[model samples]
Target: MTATCTWRIWGLEASLTVTDPHRLGEARSIVDTIVADVDRACSRSRPDAELYGRSIRRGRPTRISPALCTLVDAALDAARASDGAVDPTVGRALVSLGRNRHLATESGRPEQAAHADGTLHVGPADHTVIRRHGDMLVVPEGITLDLDATAKAVAADLAADVIADEIGCGVMVDLGGDIAARGETPVGGWQVTIDDGPDEPRTQIALQGDCAVATSSTLHPRWRHRGRSMHHIIDPATGLPAEERWRTVTVVAGRCVDANTVSTACIVKGAAGADWVAATGLPARLVAADRSIIGCNGWPAPDRLAA
Candidate 1:
């Protein structure tokens, strides 16, 4: 029997499910710890949070927790994979766009964003001491890190794996719409509902064993600034919202972080987005600003009969 519960977390909703209903409590506890660790390490809004207003400014090495280092590493990997389409160095750009730590509508101090001259860098391989220090992160001066792009997905992936390992059962963790699964597959596998905001067509898909699904959309989490519409997905090149060639993009991958990375990058890739995702060969659904759906790389067609 699959048991699940929902609650608010990280300014979003989180759902946890365990194949063995009795393990729900244990699973939830594990997930709670994972999310707390992430928030404590990566929160940009909390004054006391490790990353709050923390900038290296001038290629200086800064000390951070191992957990945060791992998260930043993932973000950098995403940026590298997407060719800077999904950048972790856009924190200051976001601030310039009026997004504060709370993601509130109020404008923020522009000085808090990553500087125009980007010189961000990471430490050497795991356990290796680099030119400066051991396990020390060298964030360029004025480069503020914002791991928001992959934070929730990281939490989901981490929670699912930890819960399954600790409880010896199948588990699925969904942070907002970023979902991850591990261990045994339930009776019908993992049925995921893809909904990108209101009035948008929705669909369901199934997954088995370990897998992940995530969606990035421009329809929601938007606001008006300087009398112009804006969104959270910033194009590092322009230091502004992704030009909305595609309104939403969802991808399924072996991991939630990868899925989110590709999906978010798809939004920023603009006209070449579909082709870009198609090249990755991951099944994905792209919805244009006009709400027209385009399925690629084996994405299930809505008109096709379910077999």
Candidate 2:
């Protein structure tokens, strides 16, 4: 039994598939519930969202919902593990880059601008703690934290897990291009197409049960600003758009959150990102700006064109 449904959520076209014939509606309902919950939990545009409320209060320890708390903990852990390369406190920088508004509906083109100096302290998970000091204002009043980098992947993983546990069937959650799957459906693994642009398409990826995949690229929806083309991925160290050494990087990991974390880190790491991905023993595909394709040792190349 095969059924598919698509809708807009988390700033992208989300699609779900369930192999159980009798549970099609159930699967779609579960996906809808999860997407709504994720929107409530992570949306920065909402005035009353926990993150937005916390951001407005400025430096005070605001209590967050359990789901958001979990995401924050995951993000902070990733930041520590990646040596601050995947910092979540770059919200201010993102806003200054004209991403302060929601991307899903905002039609204005990307614009770049210099940002004020400041630092934000996230938490010990128990309380918001100011771990360091910097010149920039800490937590600008009314600032919104965009979890575009990680939340959707987290939602996909969570939704897949919950659906499988409750319905006793396989589940696949695709939030934009980030995906998570549980149980089984496809014979070899879920076939995924990697798109770099119209002219260049690469091999399909086979993702198996209970795994997550995420891709980060400097080419998507990017625009020129101040004599330089800037993408959404920002380098925390420089407080600027990351240098585009690699056009795209994809990572497969044990969890969607980890995949999300590492994929974003790869963009900032540039050419060395491929070596770092290799050292982790995780499968990865890297497309350089020069159009060279590189994959981890075990990643299979597609027999036919991916497009």
**Predicted structure with the largest lDDT when compared to the true one:** 1
Q: What's the lDDT of the predicted structure labeled candidate 2?
A: 0.68
82-191, model 2: which lDDT tens digit per residue? 66767766665565555543422222113433334332222211112322222212333333345667777878888889888899888788888788888866665676
lDDT of residue 104 for candidate 1: 26
Query: Global lDDT of each model?
Result: 0.79, 0.68
Collision count for each candidate, in order: 6, 3
